[model samples]
Target: MSEKNRDGKRTARERLAVEREKQKSAEKRRRTLIVGAGVVCVLGLAAVIGVLAANAGKDKKGSEEAGPVVAPSGAQGKDSLAIPVGKDGAKSTLTVWEDFRCPACQAFEAAYRPTLHELADAGKLRVEYHLVRLIDGNLGGSGSLRAANAAACAQDAGKFREYHDVLYANQPEESDDAFGSDDRLIELAGKVQGLDTPAFRKCVKDGTHNSWVNKSHQAFEAGHFGGTPTVLFGGKNIYQDQSMTPAKLKEMVEAANRG
Candidate 1:
C-alpha cells in the first residue's frame, strides 16, 4: 500500500540497499580472515629465526676452543703433551692438563698420582701438572678460573703440587653456584700443607696466572681434550682408547719407557 508497493515492483533503490548489506557482511568476514593469517605468519617466522640464532651462537663458542688444536683421535695427547714423564728427570716426560671440578680428572689423579710420585721421587721421571679450567661459561657458568688462580697462588708458595691435590680432593659437584663463588675455593686453599695463606691469597686474587689455565680449556673445544685426565706422554697420548686411570697411567708410562 505504500508508495513502494504502488510501483508494483520493489524500488530499484531498495533492492540496491539489500545487496549492499550482503556485500558488507562478506567483506567483513574476508578482512578478519586476512588479519588472522597475517598474524600467524609473523609468529611462525619469529620462532624459526630464534632457533637458528641459538644454534649459531653455540657453534661459535665451540670453534674458538678448537684452535692450537690437539686432535684426540690418534695417540691421545701423548706426542703432543709428552706423557710418561720419566722419573729422576729421565728421558721421557709426562705432563697433565687437568680441571679440578672435572670428575674424570679427579678420578685420573687418584688413579695415577701414587705411581707417578714413586717414579718421580725415585729419580726416574719428571711429571708436571698443568691446571686447566676455562670451559665453565659454555658448560653452564661453572668456570674453573677461581681455582686456577688459586693454584697459581699455591705455585708461588712452592706448594703448587700439593694445593693441586687438595683442590680436586675437595671439589664440589658441577653447578652454577659451585665454580662461580671464590669463597669455597679460598676456603679449600687454606687446607693445603706448606701453603702461605696470605701470599697464596694475594696471588689468586690478582688473577694473573689464570691465563695459563684458560689455554688448556680452550684446548678442550678443539677435541684435544678427550675428557679429564688428559695425559701427554712424551708429547703423545698413550691411552687413546679410554679415560685415564692411575693403574692404566702407570702401565702406559712404564710401556713408554720401554720404547
Candidate 2:
C-alpha cells in the first residue's frame, strides 16, 4: 500500500475508536443518572412513610392513654348514659339533655325546675338527665365536662337531684369556666347535704366519670339535637315548641298519666 493511503487508513481507525469510546461514556452517564433518580425517589417515599407511621403511633398512644369509659352508679338508658331522678314506674319519661355552661340551659332549668320537681316527687314523671359538654366544644373550655362529672359523682352518693339543682342555680356566666375547677365543684357539693364526703371529692377531682360524660356527649351529637336543654317528653321534642311552658308540661304529664 502507498504510505499516504496507510497513514489515512490508520487515522480513520483511530477516529472510529475514539467515537466508540464517547458513545460508551455517554451510555454509562445516562445509566448512572437514571439509577440516582430512582434512589432519590425511593428515599423520598420512605421518608413520607416514616412520618406517617410516626404520626399514627402517636395517635394510637394518645388513644391508649385516654383510659376506659366508667359509667356512674345507677346510670340508666342505653349504654348507661342517663342519670335517672325519679321512680322508674312513672307514667311519663322526661329526657333532658343539658350543658352546665349553657346559659339557655340554665334559663330553661330556672323556668321548669319547679314543675319537674313536683312531677318527679309525685311519681308522675321520671326525669332522665343526660349531661353533655356542648359549651366546652363551642366556647373552648372544660367546665361543662367537669360539671357533668361532678354531677355523676353526686349520683353515686344518691344526691344527684339536689346537686344538679344547685349546679344550675349557681351556674357561672356562659363565658366563665368556673366549673372547670375541681375546688369549685367540691365547694358546690357542700350545698347538697351529705354530698361533700371524701369519696365524692376524690371522684370530682379525679374525673371518675369523664369518659362517661364524653360518651354521653357523643350520644347527644348522634341524636342530632339542635342545642343544649333538649327536652323530650314521650319521645317528642317538646322544647322545640314555642308554646311549651312549665304549666303546659304539667298538663301533658297529667294527660299521659290519665291515659
Candidate 3:
C-alpha cells in the first residue's frame, strides 16, 4: 500500500475513536442526571408521607384528649343523658334541663320541688332531669360543669334525688363560682345518707362524669332552648309561660294521669 493511503486510513480510525469517546461521555452524563432525578422524586415522596403521618398523629392525640362520653347509670333517653327521677310507668314525663349554677334553675326547683316529689311518688309523672353547663359557658367558670358531674356521681350512688335537692337548696348566687370547689360538693354530699362514701368522693374528685355533662350540654345547645330551667310537660315548654306555677303543673299532671 502507498504510504499516503496508509496515513489517511490511520487518521480516519483515530477520528472514529474520538467520536466514540464523545458519545460515551454524553451517555454517562445523561444516566447520571436520570439517577439524580429519581433520588429527588423518592425524597419528595418521603417528605409528603412524613407530613401525612404527623397530621394523623395530631388527630389521634386530640381525640384522646377529648376522652370518652360516659353516660351515668340508669340514664335514659338519647345518649343516655337523662337522669330519670320517677317510676318508668308514670303516665306523664316532665323534662327539666337545669344548670346547678343558675339562679333561675334554683328558683324553679325551690318552687316545684314538693309538687314534683308528690307526682313522682304517686307514679303520675316521671321527671327526666338533664344536667347542663349553661352557666359555665355564659359565666366563664367550671361551677356548672363541676356541679353537674357531682350530680351524676350522686346518681351513681343512688342518692340523686336527695343530693339534687341539697344542691338546689344551697345553690350560690348567679355569678358565684362556689360550686367549682370539689370540697364543697363533697361536703354537701354529707346531707344525704350513704352518699358521702369514698367511692362518691372519688367520683366527684375525678370528675368522672364531666364528659357526660359536656355531652348533655351539647344536647341542650342542639335543642336550641332559650336558657336554663327549661321545663317541658307533654311536649310543651311550660316554663316559658308566664303564668306557670306549681299548682298549674300539678293540675296538668293530674289531668294527664286521668287520661
Candidate 4:
C-alpha cells in the first residue's frame, strides 16, 4: 500500500477507538449516578417508615397502661364517682357519663350547671359522674384518659366538684389535645382550693387512677350507652327526648316524687 494511504487509514482507526472509549466512560458515569440515586431513595423511605413505626408504638402504649385501676374512696356504684349535692332524701338520681375532652359534655355542663346544682343543692336529685375515655378512642390521644384519671385524683383530695368545674371552664378546643400533659393537669388543680398539694400532684403524675379510668370506660361500654354526656334520670335516657330541657328535668323529678 502507498505510505500516505496507510498513514491515513491508521489515523482513522485510532480516532474511532478514542470515540469508543469516550462513549464507554460516559455510560459508566451515568450508571454510577443512577445507582447512587436509588440508594438515597431507599434510605429516605426507610427513615420515614422508622418514624411512623415509632409514633404508632407510642400511641399504643398511651392507650394501654400497666396494672389494675384503684378506685378512690369517693368512687361509688359500678365505677362511678358520686358527688352528692342534695340532702339524703333526693327524689331522683342523675347519672352522667362524661368525657373531659368531649365538646358536647362541655356544652351540657355550661347549659345545665346552674340548674343541676340548684336541684342537687336543694336535695332533689343525686348526681353521679362516670368518667370515660371515649375521646381518647375517637381522637387518638391520651387527653381523655389522663383528664379522667386526674379527676379521680381530685376526688382523692376532696376537690372533685371544684376541679371538675374548673376543667370544663378551661377546657381546650376538642381538637387540641392540651390535657395530655401532666403539668397542665397540675396547673388546673391549683385553681381548686386545697387540690395542689404534693399528694395530689403525685397521684396525677403517677397515673394513680388510670386503672379506675379504664374500668369506668368499660362500665360505659357495658351499659350500652351511645356517647358522652349520657344523661339518665332514674335510668331513663333523658337526652333522647327532644322536648327534654333543663327546666323539664326539674319538673320530671318533682312529678316523679309526687307519684
> What TM-score goes with each of the models?
0.58, 0.75, 0.74, 0.74
| Candidate 3 lDDT (Cα, 0 to 1) | 0.79
| TM-score for predicted model 2 compared with the true structure | 0.75
Model 3 residue 117 distance off true place after TM-score fit, in angstroms: 0.3
Q: For candidate 2, which ten residues in a row score worst on lDDT? A: 56-65
Report the Cα lDDT for residue 227, model 1: 45
Give the best candidate by lDDT: 2
Clashes of 1: 31
On a 0 to 100 scale, what is the lDDT of residue 44 in model 3?
30
Q: How much does each candidate deviate from the true structure in C-alpha RMSD?
A: 21.3, 24.2, 27.3, 20.5
Candidate-wise lDDT, in order = 0.55, 0.80, 0.79, 0.75
lDDT of 2: 0.80
Error at 197, model 1, angstroms: 2.6
Report the C-alpha lDDT of model 1 over 132-218, residue by residue, as the tens digit: 553344243334656765666666566666777787687776444364455666777667765657766665555545544455455
lDDT of 2 by residue, 1-259 (tens): 9999999999999999999999999999765542343333233223433444443443221111264789999998899999998899999999999888776677678778899999999999999999987666555457888999999999999999999989989998767889988999999999988999999999987888888887887788788776667789878888667778899999999999999
Model 2 residue 229 lDDT score: 70
What ranges in model 1 sit over 4 Å off?
Answer: 1-88, 219-223, 242-248, 251-259
lDDT of 4 by residue, 1-259 (tens): 9999999999999999999999999999765542343333233233433444444556532546776668876577744444344456776888888888877678678768898888887777788888877766655578888898899888888888889999999998766789888999999998998899999999988888887787777777677676667788877877656577788888987787787
Error of 3 at 116 (Å): 0.2
lDDT of model 4, residue 195: 91
